[model samples]
Target: MATTFPQHPSTRLLRDLTHSLPMALLRTREAVVQRFRTVLSRHGLTEQQWRILRALDGRDGLEVSLLAEQCRILLPSMTGILKRMESRGLVRRDANQADGRSTLVRLTEASQTLLEQIKPEVVEVYKEIERILGKRKLEQLYALLEELEAGLLEGQS
Candidate 1:
């Protein structure tokens, strides 16, 4: 005999997962990241490392906790990532002068040169996206995403 189960009321009220905002955003993110993945792979950098490099590009240095926050990397994972980056001579860590317990991280000259080399290719990827999306639509997309983020964040506090 076959059995049937009643659906939960909350489940019935839910939107289809594919059409949900978070899922849609994630799907779009995956689609966009795929394009950049090739460029990053060619440079022997992972997406997280690229984020860290960009975060540290213009600054003197940032404390480990602050750098992790800016990079959207968890503190635990940041340790391993920074360890690998330091080993590769991409970044350096110095004791934070303000706080003896904290460390400050900065990109090394080699990583700065690598960023310079990679910038043009990365810009080309942006150009390609702009060309496909059209300038106005791309701007609108950015504005909408920013507004959505701001709105959600406002509710948190």
Candidate 2:
């Protein structure tokens, strides 16, 4: 008689040996984004809009391509975001002086003021999450995520 083995690992073995890190990460990201979305909702801002605002907020003025790179968004999506932000008076876009073909993006005074007002609330959200996760775990999580991002981005490059 011949002995046969199962094609897949046993459920107990899978549960014990394999960590659902990816799924856990996805859920955590979704939860955090949802919380941030709630904050943005008060100001009628979408997630993409917030991302663009933060990118422009960090660097007063940037080219569309640079904004796209910072936000990790596609060019077309960034174009639409700019249009919406422009309409809402949150951002201004002009032809780059050095290169007319390139568009420059900047946060308008209104957008800057809005960002300043919301900065505390944003920080509060992060603080709350850190408190929940505890400082040590949060730091560890940040380190691990940074490593993962660096690896993935390096591979892309």
Candidate 3:
């Protein structure tokens, strides 16, 4: 026979894991990403690949580490992503002239052309989001998100 501790409200550790900020954000992201997945799939691109390509679209050449940072992708993971994209003729990497140890990545002509072709579809998707949220609310949402990010970053220091 074993004795068990009595449960009490004071002893409760968390309200609910489902209500966690990270999980909530992830759920919202998944919802938004689902809406874009079809368009990406039709273009024969993975979400990560698309992000990398979009990050490099207008830029001439960005350092691999900087590109990964801007795209919020891990460096090791980006290496594989770039390899696949390079094989597809969507991107190319060149050694940084200033630093032989560092590499820079840039979009290829094919990807640039593809981006131009897909602009309308992507814009349509953005319009649909605006339609759903309304312009004012969308603007508010962006402001609120930026505020939250700034607040959190500020708190870190």
Candidate 4:
């Protein structure tokens, strides 16, 4: 027996999944993240945790809301991530002076030390990526991605 799928109505249009902008971006993101997923897992870190740590690595106190924005995580999700990191002694949150309602977060000494230890491995992953992608092509990819993001943002407004 043969199975067949229904066809799209003539008045409707649909984009192919392989050619979808959102799906392509998601696939590309997953592919790049897979390159470093093992290293993060070995260090007992999730991708979101690593992103938050990296964002706060060399910076001063960043407000929780701002940290969420920088990490590209939602505020509700950020709170849980912060809570877990706090339990692990990887991060600490302090009351914001100017805004009493807001709290600031920064990496703890334990995390700083862990980051120092993981720095080499992280750098190696990046070097390998550049090696495989070719430095020039990688730069161009970055530029194109930024342009695409900016264009999308502009379209929203």
Per-residue lDDT, model 3, residue 97, is 95
Range of the 10 consecutive residues with the lowest summed lDDT in candidate 2: 9-18
Can you write out model 3's per-residue Cα lDDT over 1-157, one digit (the tens) per residue?
9999888877487668688788899998898898788889999998898888888888988999999998899999999999999999999999999999999998999999999887788889899999999999999999999999999999999
Instruction: Give all TM-scores, in the order shown.
Output: 0.92, 0.83, 0.88, 0.90
**Regions more than 4 Å wrong, model 4:** 1-6, 9-15
TM-score (C-alpha, index-matched) for candidate 1: 0.92
Candidate 2, residues 1-157, lDDT tens digits: the string is 9999776755655543235777777887899999899899998899889888898886758999988998889998888878988999999998899999998999999999999988898999999999899999999989988999999999997
lDDT of 4 by residue, 60-102 (tens): 7799999999999999999999999999999999998999999
Give the Å shift of residue 120 in candidate 1.
Answer: 0.9
Can you list the residue pairs that collide in candidate 4?
A: none
Q: Clashes in model 2: which pairs?
A: none
Residue-level lDDT tens digits of model 1 in 39-81: 9999999999999999999999999999999989999999999
Residue 86 lDDT in candidate 3? 96
What is the Cα root-mean-square deviation between model 2 and the actual structure? 4.6
Which parts of model 2 have CA positions greater than 4 angstroms off? Answer: 1-19, 155-157
